[model samples]
Target: MAFRQTVGKFLGNHAETNENHLDVSLQTHYYKTTKDRALTVLRNFFEKNEKFRINAVSNERGEVSASIIKGKKAFIVGTVIMVRPHQTVVDFSVTTESAFPFDFGYSTKVIHRLYDHMDKELPTIPKTNR
Candidate 1:
């Protein structure tokens, strides 16, 4: 079984007039793991998970782009960085394609679900030196 926890700060959220989309970004809570391991775990999750399809990836840049085309279409891009030794930061930007002017906070829910998935999937360690 995977351990589940919500860890991340919502950076911002807004709608793009040009594209008619709602998007939000979140900074995951600090993790005591290497950048490579973090990126690989996310990549594997996105690739194998039925909900998401890996669109593009750059291991060197620590980025992964994916899309979920279920009930609502969403484009997701995640970036991983090692801010401190054994501490990795993963940022995610999720954009949902919608026709309505407002999504009734649907975009935010998507981000939260994504974070939940990460919390369960990613490795866990003692929250020390944070």
Candidate 2:
């Protein structure tokens, strides 16, 4: 990780996953499932979890947005896309609402938890460099 990322994570309110993020938990995840199935799983998770309030969901786009309303108010976006048959990708973006400017990596932890939940719901395949 870069110096800026190090400091930002120490006192940041936002975190997102990408193809090459240094944080493994913040990297895009690959699952052996169809995009629609992956989207359904994500939507179900956000809806079932009392801490989350789902904002929007698009089955056609395979995207879902939700807000965390319990411990910390935060907005989260989940996206799913199928690269190949039975190969889907899931990514998350989370931003915490805080009185102070920083949440001390709370957003990152939220993403980690979401990913962990998804991992348990579906079979995961190792992410491939692209």
Candidate 3:
């Protein structure tokens, strides 16, 4: 049997509670492959992105996980879960305490950026029979 992988990313902000903090999380899984590849991808992202402040990274069995904090007021969070030699899944979202003047446009741009990044990086996994 071949190994599989899963990756997830989540991003959000709490403008109501505190307008100066953003929460971010990233998680990657390597079911049948080595953990090094996942770790390398995650570590490189953290190191390069000044907006992200890594909170944690842990490995348990076949999972490689990471969490971080990002931007003040304008929160951004993302997660990446890979299910493996062939599958990768990602989910990302954002929220604010009060809607800004250009809230609709802003949100749309954010979503677009997220989708673009995912498309460029992970692509999409095809459904398979269990």
Candidate 4:
């Protein structure tokens, strides 16, 4: 698996007035498994966030688009699963076009923790088989 990280601007009104943009980026991995399994993990994570809403779901393309709204501030996150017979990787991002009057560090940390929790919790198979 190949992973790349880069900072870019988010385009939208969700950004804060002072900063009005975010450093958009992602951490990706190549897994030796099926893509559907990986996507199930990601989907479950976003579903846990009450503020997050799924704007789209496409199983054939293996993509999910979602957004989180807090007051007037909003953040958009999306993930796409790329699968081959022997490998899979998820590409994802979090972005906001506007900067609200809030702590960027805290906001970003919260989002990061949610992502981490999803990565940790969603992928494992249940011990009790149906």
TM-score of each: 0.71, 0.93, 0.40, 0.55
lDDT, each prediction: 0.65, 0.89, 0.37, 0.50
Indicate which candidate wins on lDDT.
2
For candidate 3, report its TM-score.
Answer: 0.40
TM-score, candidate number 2? 0.93
Q: Is candidate 1 or candidate 3 better by lDDT?
A: 1
lDDT by residue for model 1 (1-130), tens: 1122111112223221111122223335556689998888888888777888899999889899888877777788878888788878777777766675445555567666766766786765434545
Q: Which residue runs does candidate 1 get wrong by more than 4 Å?
A: 1-27, 123-128
| Candidate 4: worst-modelled 10 consecutive residues by lDDT | 1-10
The residue-by-residue lDDT of candidate 4 on 1-130, one tens digit each, is 1221111122122221111122432234445557777667767766876767777777788777777665434554444455456456555544543445433443345355655665574452222321
RMSD (Cα, Å) for all candidates, in order, is 9.0, 1.6, 11.9, 9.4
On the 0 to 100 scale, the lDDT of residue 67 in model 3 is 33
- In model 2, which range of ten residues has the least summed lDDT? 121-130
Evaluated with TM-score, which candidate comes out highest?
2
Models sorted by lDDT, best on top = 2, 1, 4, 3
Residue 14, candidate 3: C-alpha displacement in angstroms: 9.8
lDDT (Cα, tens digit) per residue for candidate 3, span 73-94: 3444444444555444444344
